[model samples]
Target: MDHTNKLFVIKLTHTLIWMFFVAVIFYVVYSGITGAINTYTWLGIVLVIGEGIVLLLFRMFCPLTVLARKYSDSQKDNFDIFLPNWLAKNNKLIFTTIFLIGLVLVIIRTLF
Candidate 1:
């Protein structure tokens, strides 16, 4: 396949995998907050916090997007992924807010 096609494949894989990750993260948090205190509770918190560290390390841009930029030149908000334009543009904000809320819920449930 050509370079562009290869890049598209990589980006598509990344986007699909990321969607799964988002779902699992949310599930973990929800479970943790709802009294399912188990490994998932800690795992979920650690993973989300780790994501925050990675985001900071990448200067708030997803590392995959930065990598995709090296391969493709499309500037459309969703060019690198299948997300909506607004979502692709402000994913960090949206997910970060959700993550924070989930994290709070986890903490609160763990504490009391």
Candidate 2:
């Protein structure tokens, strides 16, 4: 496929994934707030805020942003870490980082 098609497909995929994520998060937050789930405290509220910020950041500066930059500048790279076909690639690392950071934040919040 041409670069335009590749970018288009990637972007469309990203948009769909992002929409699903937002919907899930909203549903969970709504459930939490409405007592559909177990009781929640201020920590739940803070987690919701964190989720929103992370989602916004992903939407605004996604892996595809690098593709746009490369396309605009006509630059070529050896390979892309976030390429579409690297299934299950680097996922553990990314998730581990997220988990660690979230765990640390929760611990600090609990302590403080």
Give per-residue CA lDDT, model 1, range 34-86, as digits (tens). 76767876776687778779879999766777888877888887777878889
| Decoy 2 TM-score against native | 0.42
Residue-level error in angstroms, candidate 1, position 31? 2.1
True-structure lDDT of candidate 2: 0.49
Score candidate 1 by lDDT. 0.77
- Give each model a TM-score: 0.85, 0.42
Model 1: colliding residue pairs = none
- Candidate 1 positional error at 30, Å: 1.5
Evaluated with TM-score, which candidate comes out highest?
1
User: What digit string (tens of lDDT, one per residue) describes model 2 on residues 1-112?
Assistant: 7777676666567656545544444544454444454334344445645655764778734465466555445333312223334333443344435444444554454565
Residue ranges of candidate 1 with Cα displaced over 4 Å: none
The clash numbers for all candidates, in the given order, read 0, 0
